[model samples]
Target chain A: MGRRVKVLLIGFGSVGRALAKVIALKRKIINSRYGILIDVVGVADSKGMALKAEGFDEYELLKLCEVPRSGVNLFKPYAHQGVDLNILYSNTQPDVHVELTPSEYTSGEPGLSNIMYAIDRGAHVVTANKAPLVLKYKEIVSRALSRGVRIKFRATVLGGTPFISTLTSMRSHDVERIEGILNATSNFILTEMHEKLVEFTDALKMAQALGIAEADPTLDIDGVDAAAKIVIISNILERPLKIEEINRESISRVSLRDIIDAVRQGYVIKSIASFDVRGGKASIRIAKIPRSELFAQINGVMNGVRIRSDATEVVFIGRGGGGIETAHSVLDDIVSLSFEDS
Target chain B: MLGRRLCVVKIGGSLLRDSKSYIESAQKIREVFVENGYKAIIVVSAAKGVTDKLVQVAKGSQEALRHIVEKYLEVAKELNSVKVIKRVNEELKRLEIVAGAINRSGVDLSLYDFLLSFGERISKILLVGALEATGVNALELHADELIVTNETFSDASIDYISTSANLEKLYSSIVDSPTIPVIEGFIGSTIDGRITTLGRGGSDYTATAIASLLNIDRVYLVTDVDGIMTADPDIVENAKLVRTMSYRESLEASLHGAKRINPKAFEPLEKFYSSKLIIGSWSKFGTEIVKEIPRELWGPKVIMNRASQDMSYMAIVGEGTSSVQFIRNVLEIIDRNGIEILGLQSYVHRPSLLVYVSSTYELKTLHLLHKELFEGV
Candidate 1:
């Protein structure tokens, strides 16, 4: 009722649905706390899009959350044919564009093009989709800057907390090194293997059963997910790194034997991602560290990061990869952007 | 008439068996509530014996898990909706994965609770499918998403404050609309989102809790039986149907081993008393129960034979049943009938009395008590 921020949403997967649920659940609180009302002007899924020029209400958003997986086109009365991002933007102009398409590291397709279209329209872009940001953070940021529009992707990396924003605020110090357990699926498997004395295959199966790991966990186990976060972190630190620039070692390399051996020596095998700012090198490896270290204590689906600079070192830790957690991150970005003077 | 009169109807597990049964139940709801200008929140239990099968699977029963997957898939196929079938298959696939993990690892209580919950969760889907197939618009509200509870794994209690807030917020938006929301019963989630079950026979508890919290006036605990009987029908051939009962009498009757009721259900009704519970079959809905019994109806409503240690006892349950006058009358009856008893125990605070007797005379005492108290002999 105070100030309304119109948004166009791209993607309707788990994260997207969770975002809708949270928005519907928090509508009154958000309006009261921030004096801002967020109205999703349009939503695009793989099948098609749904649009309303005045933006959707809580009831519509809640219904959208229940739409079958990739079945937004089935939503009646308001369901529009085709998922062309350009059509969505042109139909009803939005103040902010939120992109949540699944990460497409190689091409960042759809998301890359969708985000570029939003920026071209002079709209502030808030993206939880890591593909576009990982590929062309500088280009995206520069384009948004030139257009005098803000781009917030806090959900792209360590989104469980304000990791990127904190890093930005510490620019006054001479940055030295960064290390973290960035991938929740890999971390969960490692934790299960260590605590339960299970083999690699068993641990991964358990992770899959528990939904910590996806059906095809190649991206997570092969360290590609960690590498993506590292690339995003590197870019945030103004290092201008690319996704392919970071070397990745699969966490699968660690076996039950390795874990036992590590435990015998008061150490644990953890999938750790590191960036040496001074040397300009970054990689995610299966590293062995002493049992009492902060990274060793980071277990299950919880992610943790350690950053060191000339003045001090600090640790940040929280849940990282759940849809609801990432949805909150996306919501926070949307709300923060809504408060800024246009 | 006045803004759609509201009621809560809980379809018990006994009323759900095959796809046909689910359809029949949905039709009954449509005829009784939907078509009657009423807005009802339908709470449903797992299909008959599904929870037992899941309990076995949770205890490492290999055969039961396969039975569950086949049974649910078959029922979903019978529903004939591709969308419903797909969703049910996905849920069963997830269930299989969780079961596999539980089998690999030793059984953990938390996981066991989550495993047992598949019964209600899957049934909710099938029921929703059934409702839609019957030309009734229904929505599936997974109990995990709404029924917030304490941290107990198998016997969790609903945290009314949190659950009330959730129900008010979620249901208010749709209560005025024509579509109905069907929620799974006997299951809730911890505040942290871990699945917890409300013990067995807890579906009635779930229904009453919603009615009490939402301030609805009536709850139908739809089961296979025709309301509460004066005695166990299997034991006593002349058992009569109890037309009415006080909330306390039902609670006491259930506590003393009376058939067809769960003592756990009285918590919400006792605390709030905002709703009345009617227990019966879908065809014949009768047996009204409210917070207080009328003075004329404040007498023994049921008699049950129960065993404690090596002693068997006959329990008489009703309001004002623990008074000295009633005890004197019961003693006079035992004397008149030449029925020997070991002891009689009653608490003035509770509306029940336990009359202990030898096991040989247990049935005799129950029959005599039913004849004298319930049959008005």
Candidate 2:
């Protein structure tokens, strides 16, 4: 009934496939509810790129889910394999560019370059990748603002469980401080240590087996992931914090003995990530929280963020680090961007 | 790949103990199906001890995680493909991320199912690699993407209509593809995409569901055992394999503590489409369960000892088990043997008769019934 929102998906990994599935399955519902139909015009993965001017059909989208290589194979007779991203973008004019490339925190190469390219090309950007925002949040935000395009990164934190959107919506209430379990992997490991009486390394190993920890878990265990989240939340709160400025304490030092001792003292050791608006500082550390506290009860792969504001103290808790869950948030941003244009 | 006969083969967790078995299984698939011009959809479970270890990992045993990674890595090494090994490593890395999250976060049943799924997911990848190494074109198909279930978490039931629709759509897409789709069993997903597992021993259910959904003729449930035995092999030295059984009889055996086939696996065959279920090991063609039994085969098929101390004999008779003549014959046998029946129950619809007796006369009763029903005939 309304204008179709043309979209270009930059990554065809699990999260990308998940987003495509959601769009295909929920197309009718989305169109009826939001008055906009999503037309996925282009999709690019490591293998190559697939572009269709008339938008991919449901069958093609389903094929993309099973494609072993790049989604370019989904286009079959009409696909342009191994096409460069810049050329692909210029050829297929999509209004919204959905970036889901893997995060590279240190340099933010691919995600940073991809976002900048999309913004420069006058296309609105919606990203689930956190690296670009963590490395260059202010620069990217300012660049997008200057270009008169919008950038939504709700999926960057809490796997798209309304952490950023909720905080931004409460901007009218003058928030004083924010603290909770921002990183699900670290929180899960800490909970495992306390409940199962295993050492930190053991807990981390279990997390890895369960697909909750990355192979290189330094970011999660060393508090870098939480610090990045704090930086993003701080930026959104108008405090603008850098990754280097945030003080972090890794969870690797936590032991079963420490957990037992804390429990004996009627407390739980939680990997708490916090931001103090007054001090303009963010910190991630293992804090002994009371057993009855909200953060103490938040356990495995689930993230909880407590916001203390002048109006109310609110706690947002949800299952984190799922491809589909994160994709839902990315889709929500894409829909929001489309609505803004209309 | 066009117009090839399709068959769904399920490999039980027990069969994947060592690298040799992985190769053996690929060879078996090639010999029995692929060479015969049939396309195989392989459904696999986690390695024998992997699921248990993963459950431990979920509960916070970091040691279990190392074993899981090492086991898969070892299998990948045996496969010896750089692409396959890299894929396995990537999956292991992803698994670490999930496990770490579960360890840090408190356990939710839904999340636990998601955690448990890595076992089968990783196994599927390894098996696909092994199959490809054996020169069979194979692809890993995550069941969570195809099988739709309710939000019941650990023990979820499949939504037949939606699942059937998804399977049909998936089949149509891959029907012409040359690659054999290797799928993970025991795990599916809610419509909203949260992971949910069909309960333990659910690989058979997955295989059967796929077979019936695709309207395939037969499904092979490859396990360690030869097939459903006449009696517990450990208890009875002369226990013999039963070649054929009916769905109702299998269900009866399952309910009375026989762990051959999952009871849920029969739902698709009984409700939607019919398929022959062949269960056995590589060396033996053990049991074949069909939709209907012929008239001659309609009698007590399996004599099971229901309990150890206060022994009870559950006679799983075939169709017409509730007939007046059949009940009379059973009573006559017990009376003639001078066996004391403490309690007795029989269902008109189901072909099962439970006879309770004292521990002393349990063996005697089983012997007499077996002699009268099976041997005498």
Candidate 3:
């Protein structure tokens, strides 16, 4: 409550909305309970940036989102709409920057561009966009560390659930194996198909109907999204996993008959993003787990992670992808960054 | 309650309503317990109101049947525990057939009991699954298996000998196995394998019965309220919490309609059991009702009152209540104020007395008694 920490957010998308929701809901929780207040001082989209040096009002931001073609160009008073990133960063020195832009694999430019700018300004970075971490983990981490600022992307792996922190904490122990249902869209489709004995297309339709799967859902169904998360994990664990190195298998190959067969066999097929760090080399793949496997039981849009560590084998289950859930994660990073507890 | 070294936490339906809260509470519980070197075995109820709604379906409310099924399915979808949802749906289908037979053949109480037990059974299974899912090595023990009861229809009496034997057989290794064993409260069974419920607010009884039978340390009945207040909070605006009370006081207060402790919950911990029972909320700082008085306490025999729409009762419970002078002193104070007491009862077995009066005189009576008890000139 003493000092209000400023936050710079890039890419005002679904995840951006979620993070903002957490700040609004947890504003009282943070102030009364944790004695910290975080302000999203700056927010930018693909078009331009908005700057409010004092604080970017959450209500205004949410209203701006509701308006058509008006992400960074909402209000005129305190909010300087349509200002570019260079002008926004230099003018309003933020404490933390949140990168949540659209993910691009070959070139993580949009996310990397904001990340570099934020780090150069001695501001911390919290992002959910996977392209930045998957493409340039070492460079970003080193830059943030050299500047004595933190870089957290809990949303990138398992939105707002602390999977990355949990993994990093268990680094003291020998983590022999790691497995999870990281992609919620694939899991939702598979669970629907298996439970109803419906065809893959019907299940995908159901997922789309329920807003669980995206319209295209190619990255999720094709295992690209989960593979990207595995790569992030590999980089965090110091295993250095490349996107090309993973033996990726898409859930689309699973036919209606395959789903029925698995159900009859007392097994549920989940898109498992896994890594075995014990061996000299690590591998990432989407493999079928028996009914007894913990990952098999995780269904719908829920995401679960099981880390077979030296001390214990623990499971972390949560809403894998939701505007609200992931937003809470981004808010969590901001809170930890501002509060003394984390 | 494990021992002097443990804390028995009963997580009721209010807390375990969703996966996020479950995981959050689990993490917080583990953090606090692990830090203090205390082991905890949490007894979880069904996610808020799922049990009652399930019962409506079983009792042949056709209109409520589909709604009940959808609720469980929704929770299963939310918790990602569809195995439970599938099993519950199958059981519900079977229940529909049984209910039809029951409707034709006159309502069988035993069948009704079996039908009601499904809620707790499903809840226990899902909660344990969820706890395990959240990385808390938790196992589910059926209340029927752990809590043997008589063949009473709605309210069943616990058969301790058989129940203890069953619990020992099923969960002896779990004491130190570092795995939390979750059991359904309020539902148990007879020797003949007939399902029976422990009755209203029976989950607390189930938790205490297990704690006493297992001889674990403390039984924490975590409810929605902070603790037993000096008066019913809704009626008395200035009701403050009585931080520490004896089991005798809690029993008296509960008898007088204080919702903190279940009256039946105290029967199991009556004897030489050292396990203390603490009544607190999910947040913290409630009342601690112990089996015996610890030496360090310094407090008067607090007057705890509860007032409903028509009735009000004040309970004065303490070891000092045995003396005739104390009783007279309390009576004379109420009498001097010209307050008409409807009922006054004292027990020789316990150190407590209850005074039930009309709700109209509650405020005036409390003012006179407060001056007499604490602010004596």
Candidate 4:
């Protein structure tokens, strides 16, 4: 009621659909609960963009998500064809830009370009994509902070279930160590292999069939997905950690013999993301965890984050990476943002 | 939902697959258990279809069982847990020897249960280790240790009194602490401590038995089904979730061939305690089964059909077996329908009874019986 906040969302994938649903369904609740009005005025996809000066209809957006190709042409008087980053800044100005683009780990170009446009337009930003952060987190975070604009990415770390927020919340306490199973894809692949006795290729195929893994599951199976997650942890811990610097161990190294051997020894083989803060330096690695350890219980695509603080080693786990859960996470950020504005 | 209570979760074989959804579900379940300060006792089935494959091996030659052993070890390798990989190989070797004896000596059906038990034994070993790997305080309790049954090999009835005592002793070691107890589902031990099976989809029974016996609040049956639906989703186009159901309804629904809860599970639950049961997809909110239902808008007391009929008999299953009053009510409807009941088998361990009927009158009998018993007076 005080001031209407406008949001611009990029991409219309599953996460986008979920995000739209959350923003719409939880709007009244958010308003009464948090006392902030959020107006999603701009939405875009790979094929095109839609712009409404006041705000787009949430119901219409949800309906569009159901159709093939994601309702690119369905926003009456507001739907525009052919998406451009410039439209976010030039024609329909937005206060916050939500980046939900397809990931490009190597370059993070799509996400990077969107962030640049959002910053240039003086818009604060929230993102669920790990690509942009994996590639240029230091540069992007610094730029937004320097401009006095917030860059909230709770979804990036553990899909908005209060993971990074919880870790950062415990900043007052000494959190010297952090470890977990951060990559759902790798976990899924491994879990499938163990349960079904399916080969790696078969497990990967099953993951793709479920749409949990990308067609090219390199990032997940190769441990890059966990790497990106670890990188985020390092940054949160204020450690100068680079993707290349971290010692990576992919689940691909796990042979059929390895799994069989591990089972024989009464142990589980979990792909673990661990961090050690010592000598004022932090290092992250992917290890084959033993069943006797806490990390071993983590199965399938679940992401578990354990923080070893001065008091207790708290573990947080959930749907680590899913469009629905990630979307909910982004909604949490918006709700928090709305509260802060109030 | 917020407070920490003792909770038992039974993960179905489908959700136990080595898939991201399965692992993620496991992690989420474990997280919820820890976050709310609930002491979790997780009973896990073999990964996905591993049990069936192991059963195939158990049925075949010893060479086939050896192959099954290799297959299990391969899974440990995939996760990169060398310790478990080694231990499972040795255990499988012993199982392989048993398989050899079964094939060489007369293959006793009881041996099938013993040989097939390895699948879940290996699974518990893997799951507990996996939990520990994630920094969750998890311990493995061999299924046979806590789940006590009679000498019946394949479909053994549980020794509830003994099982409860064993559970108490085991819980004494870890209860009130953060340690999670991982157990093998569907497998129990004879009074003499030999391996036995509760039956297919029987792991849920084990979980329910433990949950109810321990007076836990709820038993989470994490399965492939999203929740209890009006009909099998594959068959009914308009099938939607029945979000909240009574224990009676759940027993009826599942016994009438609902994809989630095993009918046998209702026995231990109904007898010792009426714990809440939530059966659903591995990582999603599911239908909650309460002990009692308000009759306001609820439809029917039971739903039954001959899921499968042969020349020999009909299978009439649902909740309320021990309730002779309820049983009499159902039989009256069947009698009024003029259906010929060939054989009726009821388990003291559960609230389900299977009635064998002549195949010729099966359809007519079920149709009339559905209206009389399910749509009820």
| lDDT winner | 1
Model 3: per-residue Cα lDDT at residue B37: 71
- DockQ of predicted candidate 4: 0.01
Report residue B268 deviation for candidate 1 (angstroms): 3.6
| Chain B TM, cand. 2 | 0.92
Better of 2 and 3 by TM-score: 2
For residues A1-342, could you state the per-residue lDDT of candidate 4 as single tens digits? 536778888888778877876675556556666677678888888877777768754444443443234455444456777887676557777888999887777788789988977876788888888788877888888888788777888998878378888887876777778877888888877887777675676666556644578767788777777778777777777774777777777777776667777778877677777777553333334355667776677776677888887888788878788766888888888767766655
Q: Which stretches of candidate 3 lie over 4 Å from their true place?
A: A1-342, B1-7, B16-21, B34-37, B81-102, B294-313, B335-344, B347-350, B356-359, B367-377
The CAPRI category of model 1 is: acceptable
B231-281 in candidate 2: lDDT tens per residue? 777866566788899998898888777887788999999987799998898
lDDT of 1 by residue, B279-313 (tens): 89977866998888779988888888889888888
Docking class of 2: incorrect
In order, candidate lDDTs are 0.85, 0.82, 0.70, 0.70
lDDT of 2: 0.82
Q: What order do candidates take by TM-score, descending?
A: 1, 2, 4, 3
Candidate 4 lDDT over residue span B1-377, tens digit each:
12347788887777665634334654776677667677778888877766677677656654556556666676666555545566566567657656554543344555578778888888776676566556675666767656899887788889999998877755653454456778899999876445799988888889989888888888888777787654434533444566777776676656656556678888887898888888787557567888876655354333344545454433444344545675676578788767778777666455566667777766666556554544333
| Model 2 Cα lDDT, one tens digit per residue, A1-342 | 768989999988878988987786666668888799898988888767888878876555654565554445444555666758777777778899999988778898789999999999999999988889988988999999999999998888887598889888985888899998888789888887877788888777777655578779998888888888888888898888889998899889888898999999999998888999878988998899999987888887789888999889988888777777888999999999998998
Q: DockQ of each candidate's interface versus the true one?
A: 0.38, 0.11, 0.01, 0.01
